[model samples]
Target: MKDSPSRPLYLAPYYIWIALFVIAPIALIFYFSFLDLTGAFTLENYQNFFSSVYLRMTLSSFWYAFLITLITILIAYPTAYWLTKTKHKQLWLLLIIIPSWINLLLKAYAFIGIFGLYGPANKLLQALGAGPLQILFTDFSFIFVSVYIFIPFMVLPIFNSLDKINPALIDASRDLGASSFTTFRRIIFPLAINGVKSGVQAVFIPALSLFVITRLIAGNKVITLGTAIEQQFLVTQNWGMGSTIAVFLILFMIIIMMLTGQKEKGGLYNGKTK
Candidate 1:
């Protein structure tokens, strides 16, 4: 039998946009990564980036972003489940999404007001008879600000996934002698993994390149690949080296995406449907 027509109207525009925007930019970046300061082909920039401190900074950025992704998934799961089941789900969603509309630079500055040496957080600790705290401009501040800024990104995908689930499924699991925890573990979590994967990708990519928040919150003591890239472009004007670092970051993201894709495919083949 001949197949019915698919959604060409929807698919055509999307494919064209993807080709023009996503595919084209990635190709340009890959090409630029191999170009030298004089616009000649060279691998020296890539070699320098992988040599010593730059390599460590790049790996550290990815590592910390990974840590934040793990934490966001753990934190978001329960909140998403709760909101999905709650009566005021729309209101909860609005609360989650509102922060995202705020300017990211403004949000980073706000953290400075909270964690700066004389900021409210430190003042509160001092009032409680604790010693002067040095939190801002540290690794902890980097993690804290990055996670806070990205929490909504993590929450929304998970909430959408959880909401797609039928309440009847949970009830059926309970009826079949599964405790609430058992139902969650065996049924809910498996179904939610796709959303979790999306949330991880959303948070990790931005967090990996977060230089403004790192500068404001971490006081320049903490360095990431993003900061290095900024320094390379603005201070040293080393486009080749910066582009090489950018390529490595892209490769790292691809590796993570591949691993996540495998997990998703494996889960699907094992009869776990989202």
Candidate 2:
């Protein structure tokens, strides 16, 4: 095998894009992480990151991301499984995904009205003889909105994985006296685990870094790593500390991807066997 002279030409745009957008930004962040407010090079930023305040923020961020991801998975798996059995599934799936095309800010604002004190949600609660509860600007509101936003992302991957399953295997399992639950547990779930992994990867990473939903929905009651980063860079004008947080965030993102990403040569059905 020899090199193709045209290969470099073909890959030039991709490499250039990565260098400019991905590599360059990461390099800049890494460089800035060691500098202080006065542009003096120091490790103080990293030192602050290890302190109790930051450690608590990091734990809280993880806890919130975990809850959002878990709720998304619980809802999405059932929705996707149902979609797989539908006649016009693609249409329904498209409907589910269309909301994601709308601007996130717009959606957040829409929820603000929906969950307002005198809004439909509270009105319904009042109709049921229950007093209007404060729904907006609460952890419940934040997690609910976040889960709603991420459901489509989670469903699409699981839907795709479920769709790829061979129909005959399911039929054989049923014919061989296996119950629906057993067949699903033994066959369908195993084959679809990769999609679950992909869905988790898609939902968890963004959930970890979400600031807008926290601001609009949670009303500063919940603060994640993203909120801290925004406060550092924009509010306090501390780019060094912000970049240090970003560098660590990037590291966490990498570690998660490594854990959830599938290998090319393995899985229950990559068409290869040992």
Candidate 3:
């Protein structure tokens, strides 16, 4: 059917918002990335970014983010699989999502209490005759908090995908003498790739950009590109350098999405869980 000209009008507000908030900001970043400290056109921002210190920090941030995403997927996929089998799955999912609604700073504070010197974790250690372990301001604490924070983002999509799989197909596979592992490996996992991709993307993008949790949990011990960007803009007052980092991050996100996303049979990005 031919679309009405007014169909475009229906999306006018969305287009306007996108232009103002998204395109305009990106264009400004592009402009900033090319400018020097004196506002002259230069590649100095990119040059400084590729320097050894910045490059090493950037790679470390990527590694940390990747580990956090990996751990979330490992835990979330099994939890989601079990959720699909439960009678009260909706309630379970609600419980999983409830914590996410809490303020992120609040969650960080809560972890502070739990991981503090005289906190419950150490108290338990003392009771067990083990010395109180220092956890605060460490890489372990940072990764722990990150995985805690992002696991829900991984769970929902995988649950949706698993929930949509046909029980009849499973039954038939079993009838045909396929083992449980074989059935899942052959029939289930491949069908759910899109959901897995969605979950990973949801977890990875924010984790890559994470700054506050690192500061709160790892102090200066953990530094991400996000922290570097903040340092450039807020402390160093280097807008050009900050914008350069932001552009690189945007490119990194695009690369990750392209690498992880699957093509649907129709030649589009496969995002629908079912």
Candidate 4:
């Protein structure tokens, strides 16, 4: 396993690419996050980010993204669990992944087709005398589209985790006087939590960063940290504040990963590949 000259040369390009592209940008972000509008070093932006208004906005953003993450897990868990028991697992997986192949903007816009004021769902409801329904430009629409867009993230992890469970465990639980719900709660759910953690991170982080979909569907009235960052950069030209928020978001992500990763690493899962 010793690295030869040829091996070092072969991997040099990837190392250089990582250093230039990834490391360089991160370094720049770190630098910018500490600067002020006048090119002077300052902590004013960070202080403002913790003020009541900005803090409330950031908390609201986390809360909404959290709601989206919870909803995605609740919906995807059952779907993924059922899919694992299906006869055509590959086909189901393909179907699940098909939406991801479409452009994210296109997929977000496609929801407009089904949930807009004159969209099919509303039209059908009106035709049935259920009256017109408001579906777009609201938190509800935001949650719905976010869930749809991120479902695959939640599902894939759960599916992978569920696939590792020995079915015989369930049979044994049943024979030992446990009901289906009890066994799942006691055995299946605990074991699958790692996957759940991974899936939730995948969904929540990106969902928190979503600005385009929020702008389009939430009428730009609802402002999350994502929207705040975008407005700071694009609208207000306040790169200092934008970078501060971005840095905060990155810190928040790291904190979440550390907490979840600790739980995962300390768990009973012994790296047994299924």
Candidate 5:
């Protein structure tokens, strides 16, 4: 059969969009990574990225991203589980997601006030006789705000996964005398593993590249690779080093995607005898 003449026409815009937005920017970054500040080709940027300073920064970025992802999962999973059990599950989920619709900068600034010296957090502490503690510009605040921002992202995927579970399977587990923990560990979580993977991919990748939250919430005390890239490009005007970091960040993102990516195989059963 002959193909439709309009098929390629239909796809042209998509191809052009990918080329301009995705391919072109990456090619530019890769090209820039090999250049020095003077626009001369050099490997110095790559060499410098492997140095102790950048190595420490990279490790710190990974650490914070891991912590944020882990904490988000801990909080989001239980919340999602409860949401699934609610009488008005969609309404509850909507409430949870509503906060995420607010501008991230607005939320950050709001937290800045909430965590400030005389803010409600400190006021509560003082009321309890512990005195106002330094909450803003601290690791706790940074992680807290990041977790708050990412919870909805994590919850949605997990909730969808959990919601898709056949009630019969859960009932079967219960009928078999499995404890709630055992049922979750053996049945529910295994089925929802893909959703957890999706959530991890959604949360972890952005967490690694977080700069604004680190600056606004952590007061530049916690510098991720994204912050370093921002400094290189904007603050220091070193596009080469920034692109170098970006190239590696892209590589990291690819590796993480690969690690978390789902594999297609038999579902429930392969319909074959062993």
Candidate 6:
């Protein structure tokens, strides 16, 4: 199955792109992580990260990301399953995807109106005679916006996995006296777990690195790894510490991808490995 040496020539552009955009930037960040503010080699950057203040921020970033991923999975699994059963799947998927087409800033801005003091949330509560409740810049608002932004990343992968399922397997399960719920528990869910892994990978890693929504919605009360990285690099002009955070972030992402990778593929319920 070995190809001619020229075969790799077709991938020259891809290799170049990866070298210039991906590898080079990561190399620079790794190099900077080893240096201090004066461009001298030192371990201060690493020390600063393990310090209590920054360590807490790192944990908070992961905690919120976990919550976002959990909620997204709970909502996306059912929605994706429903979409598979719908007559107009494409239209429904488009509706789910349409919001992503809008700019992230614009979407955050739109939510600002909804969560503002005199906005729809307060208005609706007033109508219910429950009075206004503050949501803007709170932890609840932060989680809500994260889930809203990342739900599609979760749904699309699960939907693709579900749509790829074989109908005959379900029919055979029924003919063999398996109930719908039993069939799903034993057959459907295990097969679709690859998609769940993919969805979690897509949502959680980026959530760990996002600061914008936290900034606009959660304000100074919430400090994530992304916000801390931004502060070290931009606000504090501490590139070494920022690059250290960026390196660890990349490390965490790699760990997630490895954990999510499939050991095998199955498209039908034969209780067989192919």
Per-residue alpha-carbon lDDT of model 3 for 128-180, expressed as tens digits?
A: 99999998999999999999998887888888788889999999999999999
* Winner by TM-score: 5
Each candidate structure's TM-score, on Cα atoms with residue i matched to residue i, is: 0.83, 0.91, 0.90, 0.90, 0.92, 0.89
| Model 4, residue 260: C-alpha shift (Å) | 2.3
Instruction: Tell me model 1's lDDT, rounded to 2 decimals.
Output: 0.78
- What lDDT does the true structure give each of the candidates? 0.78, 0.89, 0.86, 0.83, 0.89, 0.86
Off by over 4 Å in 1: 1-25, 261-274
Q: After superposition, how far is residue 14 of candidate 4 from its true place, in Å?
A: 2.3
| lDDT per residue (tens digit) for residues 108-205 in model 6 | 99989999999999899899998888889999999999999888878877888888899898888999999999999988998788888888877888
lDDT of 3 at 186: 96
The local lDDT score (0 to 100) that residue 62 gets in candidate 3 is 94
- Per-residue accuracy of model 2 over 1-274 as CA lDDT, tens digit each: 2666556566789999999999999899999999999999999999999999999999999999999999999999999999989999999989988887778899999999999999999999999999999999999999999998888888888888999999999999999999999999999999999889888888888888889999999999999888889989999999999999999898998898899888842233321110
For residue 6, give model 3's deviation from the true position in Å. Answer: 8.9
What TM-score quantifies how close candidate 4 is to the native fold?
A: 0.90
Write down the lDDT that model 3 would get: 0.86
Candidate 3's displacement at residue 23, Å, is 1.0
List, residue by residue over 164-190, the lDDT tens digit for candidate 1.
Answer: 888899989999999978998999999
- Native-to-model Cα distance after best TM-score fit, residue 241 in candidate 5, in Å: 0.3
lDDT of model 5 at residue 272? 15
State candidate 1's TM-score: 0.83
Note the residue pairs that clash in candidate 4: none
List where candidate 2 sits over 4 angstroms from the true fold.
1-16, 264-274
Q: Which stretch of 10 consecutive residues in model 1 shows the poorest summed lDDT? A: 265-274
